[model samples]
Target chain A: MNPRLSLNQATIKHADLATALSLTAEAGITSIGLWREPVAEVGLGRAATMVSDSGLRVSSLCRGGFFTASDPAERARALDQNRRAIDEIATLAEAGAPGSAPVLVLVAGGLPAGDRDLASARARAAEAVGDLAADAAGAGVVLAVEPMHPIYAADRGVVSTLREALDLVCDLPAKVAGVVVDTFHVWWDPTLPAQISRAGAEGRIASYQVGDWITPFPGDALLSRGLMGDGHVDFASITRLVLDAGYTGDVEVEIFNQELWDADPAQVVARVVKAFDETVAGQL
Target chain B: MNPRLSLNQATIKHADLATALSLTAEAGITSIGLWREPVAEVGLGRAATMVSDSGLRVSSLCRGGFFTASDPAERARALDQNRRAIDEIATLAEAGAPGSAPVLVLVAGGLPAGDRDLASARARAAEAVGDLAADAAGAGVVLAVEPMHPIYAADRGVVSTLREALDLVCDLPAKVAGVVVDTFHVWWDPTLPAQISRAGAEGRIASYQVGDWITPFPGDALLSRGLMGDGHVDFASITRLVLDAGYTGDVEVEIFNQELWDADPAQVVARVVKAFDETVAGQL
Candidate 1:
């Protein structure tokens, strides 16, 4: 099969879900990753139908899991919300072609209430994931845990390394746990290549996302992502490592650049495709 | 030694060198870390005389290195500049009290222009250090290589890991090379404790700096550092690790906040001292 190309809807967050889907399809990208707000905005039924009609593959749902809260009520609410997100992903999967289910990507929450006890936050995140995994397995959706960068260890996600993420996954049932390898988050990790290999050997490789690294930007919390090749990230090397890790997943371009968002969506898509092509060529 | 406290001059970049010295001494900080630009601005000889008159220990010189340039001319220029910095440091040492010379903190340069070979840049940095080490040793000063954050791997310093920095030191002449453990650059590293121990075992730890991590602000470069306790960094744990690593040096409070810079210098020094006390209390 041809190398699948997935466009994360966040690449065009300014656009509505329909516009993002239509634009992605027009660009000949077969797969897409959706954010929850757009799914809710368009209504899950309509969103699912639109995705089905557009002939676009739902590569993975954007996220589910903000489990680092200190309050028990907040934790329960997060789990409930995750269950709904999983249900929505399942709906999209069933509505799609005969045998494919969209993967649900989970961003385990950072320190709840901005508390700095990273150890406790990590434990809570792991516990939340185990709970979410059962529901995800029942929904027939693979849950991909995306460990964020360390700079976000305070208020975003406690799991900062692929090794840490894999450890968390090990606690959950294999049928419900996998890992998402995003270059933007894990590129600087010295142990990345080894972790990628370990993930592949353990059958935990779920999604491979791509973006570059730009400095002096906002905190590591979500923004500050560079367009592929625009910054210092060595994309080709990371892509090669992930591919070698037995990850045959779509190469999703998930940039969160304010500058790119300001530009024409078509131009942005075209530039990304070109960069992806060059990155692959350079790697091979 | 009373756990000598030094004010890294960048903490008061807004104030002139004389004002910074006066404020630091008045605040009971017995040592000061001087930056090259400020020394240059006030004339190296004058800056040295001022410190001597104030009876302040020059803890570690602010910087010297941008060695990883793609151009040969630029690299040579940097080397020449480092030699001059060494000469200036020698002057500071001669003017300092009887037995001590200020440690020259080396910031190994970032990636060369249009060249993303981090490994190569690191090699060049090591070579530059070797060249400067001879002079530094003869001048009765120690050359301390500071491994910056990985966020600066592209533009500021290629030495991102303490292990990497220690490895580079192995190539230098014995007793001439060491490592600077800066909390702001290394607090996020999972390998920090082990590296610090290794640095101590090898007698290669030269300096230990502290700063916090705050987000939503631009912290890409060496600047943009948060004040101690204001961010998520676990200073107590790190300080213990450093102490365990055999480092009895001053726990310098090095904050790079514009807000603090705008405030009264006396207030800033008082806050730093308070933070230090709290940090030490927690650690003990």
Candidate 2:
């Protein structure tokens, strides 16, 4: 299980809970990564019970971090939602119980509407996430701050690099805050090798996800990710870097191409499993 | 003229040389940047005469850098092309003569066909640009390394940040080499402020191009730029940084939007001049 595969729900966003669970189980993947939307649709309590019954390990919850709003009310609302998300992770589904905390992944949001102060947006994100420390710790959840690719810096997340993300959570406890190293987001970074090593040294690598970099990325850019072997990411090299840095965690595949979404859930799972075995797991 | 304005030819791309010349002159802009393609189309000799006759100082030449082919022959060919481009900058066209050199802005080419080693591609670009130093210096030309946005890291340019570009030309003499600070590209960089300061301190701010960062960028991403006031870039701060850093050069506006391209040439010139006055020149 050197490269234990965990399928992030975003990869198969169109699938329902029962189908997704069955597909992952059938594919022989014992671990999973859930999205809040899908979980809510299935009713959080029932979904938690089902995952517990099926003995599926939820590696992490998909989101929680849009604290860069200018209005006070909006800012407070985002924090409240994140707190709820943290609470959800606490009692959320996991391998053997209905109340095991999954790592909570945090996507630092973009600049507030009509505001161009990137520094302030980032500052607010750091403060808000810091504020959530008490609730996350109380719920026994780890918060992983995800620094998206720089292209997303304008409309999505201001935390555009590992160093920036680490700086944001510099004061937080290691167990309560960390960073997600997704190949899609960070593969282009020249400083990635050194940063990954530093993250490992600091015990800040909460998740090590893999995705490939493809060309002529779609207009949206968000859906530009391809299957591991289908695109150009150097999986062997990146995986080695992570492993060398002491990251012994689930290697999640989170492809977002429209073609993958249109495929039959079982076929998608089989393809993902095979891809993991060859492109990612093979590296391990 | 602390922040003297220069209209890059690309900003009024649809205009022919005659109209482009007349438009810039009519708009009261004494400086203009030219592209090799348009210059070639207008007959280099004639184009040089028109610009010189119109009393427009050529602040810079659009490009010269694609030396990252895996094929030795192709790479050699790119180098030869760049050498020719350097010659073009030195002799093709200018303010008052056919042989006066302007600052040549160079964009590092992306990966060679079927190559995934971005580091190698960047290394190749640096070596190529370094090789051009003697020719650039001999021709009284300066090579400005323009680091495009990270989104262009795949198909267009591998040099994605000012810091990386500076690293590439670190060994070259300041007069023969420098960096291009385009707001559309480096504005998203978290490390931009410090890098710009360093570029200025090192006399590496060869050209400071201004354009706004608009959202829902076009599918091409290349044409996503808008007029100064039409987008979200903070021109005031960026302009201040440039002035503080001892760069008393022309601030060029290089917008590439479909609508702007479709507008009347004179109207486009008027709009650009107005935008510069309001969004950029006003800062001075």
Candidate 3:
């Protein structure tokens, strides 16, 4: 198994924190990317302790952004939640093994219901990120803004290109805010190579997530992501692009497929390790 | 009905050429974009007579691309078929009412099966278009390259952005090789306004197609498009951008929704005209 391969907890969504950590460690994986819900379920302190005890690195926190709210009260609550998430990142980064990145992966929310103004929705997202930039900087956490595929622009994400994500964070200090280049969302972008290089030059590549886009597309658009090598994504090529872009962090295998979530997590971790080695590790 | 509005035949997929023509004309639409399959079914000569008799302008032909074939014989076959399509465009343009456009809409095919080399496949598509440019020039027909949404990059179109499509044809004469600016394919693009302007400045805006991107994305990804007002697309904004870019051509409403397909053609035409008027024609 590749030492740099991290099993993102979403791959085994049903598993508790303890089981997720054990499953990952048992498979000889040295790192994990965690979701806030599971960590909250175990209590952040207890989760930090388990991560420290397992001697595994926390690659990044799964998410912290959904910042496109138009309502003032809802916006305040979201900001408060993000600040808490920042503190959790600080705690987890302290407890985890050395080399764990204090990174919070952000998925900017989509258009508000019945709202047709995409420009304003995107502006709200950027402003929200600006609102939280100071908190992230104070906590020494990087807010990694992820660009989702355009298919999700209506209900999941408005930022749909690396160029756009990079543009949103360019004004901020790279150490405080960056971008996540997930293959499932961006593998089809023609300008990906150039934009990856630009992100590297700007020093804003916060995390790298790996997943494949399968054909005969699944019924659920969100669960359409497949395990690496099981779909059309050329992992090695994208992995090479990331390496060339100077990203040295753990590569998280973050598939959202229902089949993988339903299967034994231990087996899933094992398969992930093999897939990462076969398809991505060689490039690294 | 809006004088600039044209009904694209695929929106009424079950309708034969005659039925599509009559339905479009009965709805007071003065123009129609035709699909080659239906035109071929009636035989080009007979189809031309029917279009001429209907007194409706031919905005453009449905398609003349699929040019990403890796096999040498397959590539040659696709080029030959495109040449025929160009000839058909000329004949149809001559047969239709004044202001008919001799334009062939091009959908660059996806990556070859079991092939993950997107860059090479895209290069092949561009090369094929380059090969067809002279034939198009000879026929006085514009090959309108369309950039599909990135979701279809693996199975439908490797060209996934208007910028890339424009780049592919930038070196060629704009009159010989242009682009189709479809709202559904490009509404999510942040750079759409600028690209549309560039296409217009370069005299490459051969056709404009309008369709909305509905969410709760359907099971069949290909059939997910909706009528103009039924989804997230702000057609007025896009239509304004196209008009501001100096486009005076017909706006073809090209939807692929199964619900619309299953409806009566006359009713579908009525709904399409209403959607276009309420959502798009106002801008025009």
Local distance difference test scores for all models: 0.79, 0.83, 0.93
- Per-residue CA lDDT of model 3 for A1-284, tens digit only, reads 78788889999999999999999988889999999999999899899999999899999997888889899998899889899999998889888899899999999898888888888889999999999999999999999999999999999999999999999999999999999999999999999999999999999999999999999889899999998998899988898889998999999999999999999888888888888888999998
After TM-score superposition, the amount by which residue B194's alpha carbon in candidate 1 deviates from its true location, in angstroms, is 3.4
DockQ of 3: 0.84
Which is the better candidate, 2 or 3, if ranked by DockQ? 3
- Per-residue lDDT value at A51 in model 3: 91
- Residue B33's lDDT in candidate 2: 84
Tens digits of lDDT, candidate 2, A1-284: 33378888889989987777778877788778888888889887888877877677777888999788878999999999999888777777444333233688899888877788887888898999899998888888889999998878878888999988888877999889999999999887878889989999998998888888888777767788988877667788889889899987777888888888988878888888878888778756
Q: Which residue pairs clash within candidate 2?
A: none
What is the DockQ for all candidates, taken in turn?
A: 0.35, 0.64, 0.84
Which run of 10 residues does model 2 chain B get worst, by summed lDDT? B92-101
Clashing pairs in 1: A110-A156
Number of the top TM-score candidate: 3
TM-score of chain A of each: 0.94, 0.96, 0.99
lDDT for A210 (candidate 2): 86
Candidate 3 per-residue C-alpha lDDT over B133-228 given as tens digits, one digit per residue, 9 for 90 to 100: 899999899999999998899998999999999999999998899999998999999898899999999998999999999999998999999998
The ten-residue window of minimal lDDT in model 1 chain A covers A93-102
How many Å off is the CA of A183 in candidate 3? 0.7
- After best superposition, candidate 3 residue B113: deviation in angstroms? 0.9
Query: Which of the numbered candidates is closest to the native, going by highest DockQ?
Result: 3
* Cα-based TM-score, every candidate: 0.90, 0.96, 0.99
Please write out the lDDT profile of model 1 over residues A1-284, one tens digit for every residue.
13477778888878888888888888887778788899899899999899899887777888887888879998899999999999988888777654344678888776655465667788898888888877888888888899887766666777888988999898666668888999888876666788999999888988888888776555533678877777777777788888788877677889998777888888887777787777643553
